[model samples]
Target chain A: MLSPEGREQIKYKARKFIFGSKDTEGVGKLAAVYLLLISIGFVYLYPVLYMISKSFMNLNDLLDTSINWIPSQMYLENYKQAFQSMDYWKTFRDSVVIAGIPTLINVVICAIVGYGFARYDFKGKKLCIGLLLFSFILPPQATMMPTYVFYTDIGLINSIKAFIVPAILGQGLKSQIFILIFFNFFRQIPKVLIEAAKIDGAGHFKIFRRIALPSAAPAILVVFLFSIVWYWNESYLTQLYVVGAFTSNAGGYHWSSLIVSLKNFENSYNTARSVAGSGMVDINESIEMAGTMLSILPLLIMYLVLQKQFVESVDRTGITGE
Target chain B: MKNGRKTKPGQLERRENAIGYLFILPWLIGILVLVLWPMVQSFGYSLNKIRLLPQGMAKLYVGFENYSQIFLKDPDFIMGLESYLLETLIAVPVIVAFSLIIAMLLNQKISCRGIFRMIFFLPIIIASGPVMQQLADQEAASIPMMNVTMIEQLLDEYLPHVLAVSITSVFSNMITLLWYSGVQILIFLAALQKIDTSLYEAAKMDGGSKWECFWKITLPTVKPMILLNVVYTVIFMSNNEQNALIVLIYDTMLSATGGYGYASAMAWLYSVIESAIVIFFAVLIMGRKDVYERRARKYQRELKREKRLEKKIRKRGERNERNYAKQKAKQQRKGANKKSA
Candidate 1:
């Protein structure tokens, strides 16, 4: 029963709704976003996908260009070789201890120092903060030699104590950044809250313990996560200090991480190859990819489990401040 | 709370300060001993001949000999340093821009956003040195479809060899660069999220297109973040385990001929170069004030300078008047004395 003009107006409104107007997004834009995300996401995960696909391909499948992504069949032999070569169990345990202990120490000490900086009227506070930033800026290379000598002299070489001591003293890997994160968070706590606590006869330490620490969960989580990841991946410092690579008696106690072991995987794999009596295929791209996949398998699982926390962390933590 | 009248405010402040110092004492000690002292000792080591013996170590001062030897005798070091500088310079911008773009894209209202974020951030977890080394070795770092050789040939014709090589290397390292952008993406996204939605709405009300709104509104608000991300990117690239110079330094430290002294020199030199890159980028970003901001600042300076100049002129006039008045008084006093005589 509608007139011709009314029908045309209705059609125009529907078209506008579909194609977008000034206020809301249209289907076209959404499609574009999805397309871009998928393509980039594919590219972003290309190496990982390639690693997985290649790891599952045996010698024949790897050699055949026709077997690009899908293998002719699933293969497990590459993983077996990589696992044996990496000493997966021992290094995994050591990696946990190495990355875990320092993270705990870094979290606690950084929080204390950061809280002090945030909630104090101390003299030379600016100088202290400046020095903290300066240390963050100065590359570790500038201080590597002397610190190495000091660690060797103290008999901390080739042991976990090398990392633990510095961490206990609040000089862990990227400790300055963690301290800054805590400082930024702690600065936001209202002074009135602390004053009220003081009025209730709570001493400074009591107030910090009962009040300040509980409110800094986000900062602590961030510091803990980043510290562990950095420490786990730190082959350079770990090699120099913990493994005693250059010392007269090296590899005495045999402390190492998975990534560190993986760093020298070729040599280890070659040794293991000789011991295996040459039945294995020559070390090729597939095996190397398999070894990498093995090395990252645990981390990938962790990422899967903690993906939500890791993604939302920056948003919820306010780590990026004005 | 009970006996506050007896204690001076100074005493309370002193106690508070003492507690603060106690809290920070651990860090202070660590920085002094582990950081500052070693920095000094490392500098000293860089200027000496360090010998490893059965009983202990020996050192003889060689001054700038180690540095000169590195610069003059070692072509590889110079080439490595040059390439490091070029790569870092080119890579930082590309990484920053790429992250900023992705952050904006993610900032848009999209479904299944969490999955995309996880994919982008996946690199932070598994990009250990060995893993990256293996991937790069397998030629998996570059996309197989990129046709890098074609790009290389295309670039080689128009650019110098050094630039062409670095550009090609940058292009080839595109994926690892993407990996480096994860933290930066988070940073940019955080910065982008912080932009007040009303600003965009107002721009829309003024008939501003999305592009205009972005350039006029979004860019200025996140400008500080650009500098921050640049510095962060520079630092990350320099400290990354994949950096050839760091590996070289590590190797030099362990080698028989290179030893501690020569290695320290290399480390120091490398650090200086790294710092220079950071500073260069920092200055580039920080020095570029917005046009409006620049004008406003210049206007403010002019006002301040005008006030200061007026004060200077007035002070000079007051001084001249006082001197003239003093001279007239002296002349009058001399004439009065003469008349009295």
Candidate 2:
């Protein structure tokens, strides 16, 4: 029943589809993949997008059922309140001190210990390595009480010494994993290079300093970033150790202060509701969202700037035992 | 002289040992003072009744009474343990498999791969304790798709009892579960990239399809990584602050009437269960015959055989040269004697 021109066109299209001429199949596949990626990317980014959008909405816009993605107006007051409540500048300084000092100490100590484990053979080395891994496997909660008691006994509680002392000794936040990373990196250094250095009269310290350390730069950076992030995000220990030391009025803040502030806001709202004989809380949702956003803003910026290196670090660290 | 040479290297070895110990001295001290001592103390604390006082601490030896209370008396403790174990058992495999799939997808040559990776990994960087808590408080961590009551109603009407409940619960918290997979995906991606492309090409040339290549080459190549991911996921999930067991321990510790001994006992019990789970997964996943190891052994054997054959050929050639030299020497001596005559 087809016309001659229509039959010719159908035959030509069939041939193109079967042979995949003109790279049509490739383009179609690429389009399909892009579609899949974007959809999943949207899912992964939904919470953060929600945070940002909700943080920018005013009370009326936030409560508006139709407004979802963007706000009617850009509200800056929420940021102002979050900043004031968090004592932004002072807390930022304290966070840097708390997360930074330990990171530096931890990296150096872990690198030295890892170098020893990797490059040298000594009595009980196997046992030491076993203990290192065992410590990592054991949950910190298991030892939390005793460590607390010990720190109190030594009068190191409520102070940064609690973090620094352990870091100096290479037992800081996930230091075992850092040591293992360094161990893997040091082990990958070419034996021939070390042999050549030895023949050139380089001693153990000199070889480690001038050869192994230089070659392990990528691993060092990776561990440094991981250590910093871990220490920065560590709230459980901070809450347990330093909560009593700082009051809201004192302007001293842990990274966990955001949670405390939210809790306080809820408590104050409940009290107000009871006093007013109403079910409403005065604090708006946008302000709370703004506080949450502010809390993670520094980390988000850090990740954005160092994302390439962070991703590359995972590939280079051999943490997955590649 | 032989003894002297041997003693010199022995001395050098001792020196090296000294240097190694020196390098690890800080870690050694840390292990002794921070890790080992606290672990011992934790064990001791679990067996006693500890009371904090205004003046000093009072400790009464309870002799496993605390442990008995947890098992024989406290329903909450047992329930927490059961739920924690069940969640871990279900979540570990699901998270691992999900991350593996995501990693495979990301590993493909595609446009905007970096942006995709960044989006997936961004949650891990920013989902610190406070941030995650805040998000959960705001109900932002829930999946709207899963929250549709119609699907739940259908599941309840059609599926069996346990399957229906488990599926519903998993879907309800799907967002949090997905968030947990960021680090696992990165690890798996690294493992995926380590696989050689030539193997895939060879498989293709042998007329193997993509599915066969994936099963025969890619899966086997990343098997060890799968085990690693399983272990990592187990430990990471179990140790998080949101875990039921950890929350229980914190609550018990903070309660006015709850004793430190009881909390310590709970913590120890949790640790034991965690170790058991880790060991179970490790044994189950790692007990298979490793294809890479078999290939490596075969390659080593072939190399040894080739080396032995080469050595034999060189030995025969050297013997032939010696024989020729002796014959030439005899001929030259005879010629010299003839000239003398």
What TM-score does model 1 score on chain A? 0.92
- Candidate 2 per-residue C-alpha lDDT over B112-140 given as tens digits, one digit per residue, 9 for 90 to 100: 88989889898778766667776777777
Alpha-carbon deviation at B225 in model 1, angstroms: 2.0
State the displacement of the C-alpha of residue A3, model 1, in Å, after optimal TM-score superposition: 17
Looking at model 2 chain A, report the run of 10 residues with the lowest lDDT sum. Answer: A245-254
Instruction: Give each model a TM-score.
Output: 0.90, 0.85
Which docking category, incorrect, acceptable, medium or high, applies to candidate 1? medium
Any idea what lDDT model 1 has? 0.87
User: Model 2: what TM-score?
Assistant: 0.85
- State the C-alpha lDDT per candidate: 0.87, 0.80
Which ten contiguous residues of candidate 1 chain B have the minimum total lDDT? B1-10
Q: What DockQ do the predictions score, one after another?
A: 0.65, 0.46
Which pairs clash in the backbone of model 2?
Answer: none
| iRMS per model in Å | 1.3, 2.2
- Candidate 2 per-residue lDDT, tens place, A1-322, comes to 9999999999888777654443244555567767877877777787888889988988889778999878998888777766665656766777777788899998889999999999888889999999997888888878888888888889667667788899999999999989999998898888899999999999889999999998888988988888888877777776676543332324433343433344354453445456656434356778778877876777789999999987778899877664
